[model samples]
Target: MEPRFLLMADVAEQLNVSASQVYHMVRSGELPAIKIGGRGQWRIERSKLEEYIERKYAETAEWVRTNPLVEKDDPDLS
Candidate 1:
């Protein structure tokens, strides 16, 4: 069967972050995940990962809107 969930390591690889950082995000509730199996393995749902990426994009857009870019060398500005 096809896979529906991703391991913490997999998520870390996709996010280009360390597994420890992913663990921290999960612990801080910044990312949604679940612990399963006897070893309490962490699993991130595919859809939830996608949602997190989309949310981050939206948040970055909002931040850029609030903080204008000031170019000191721009002839139009100065």
Candidate 2:
């Protein structure tokens, strides 16, 4: 069974991004996380990470809808 919570490094690996990027997301409140232990380690819930991914998918779809692609060689380009 997968762990309920994941380390910052684990989240980074899953997202294919640098650890610092994940840390920044947490710090910026874009991704919810919790700091635990006396040393203050960050842990992100697996469900929350999944939620973030889904949210990004929705946001990307909206962006694509609003920003239609511009094809090259279009008369407008000239």
TM-score of 1: 0.86
By TM-score, the best candidate is 2
lDDT of 2 by residue, 20-65 (tens): 9999999999999999999999999999999999999999999999
Candidate 1, residues 13-59, lDDT tens digits: the string is: 99999999999989999999999999999999988899999999999
Minimum summed lDDT over a 10-residue window in model 2 is located at: 69-78
Candidate 1 Cα outliers beyond 4 Å, as residue runs: 73-78
lDDT per prediction?
A: 0.93, 0.97
RMSD of each: 3.8, 3.4
Worst 10 residues of 1 by lDDT: 68-77
Model 2 regions lying over 4 Å from their true place: 73-78
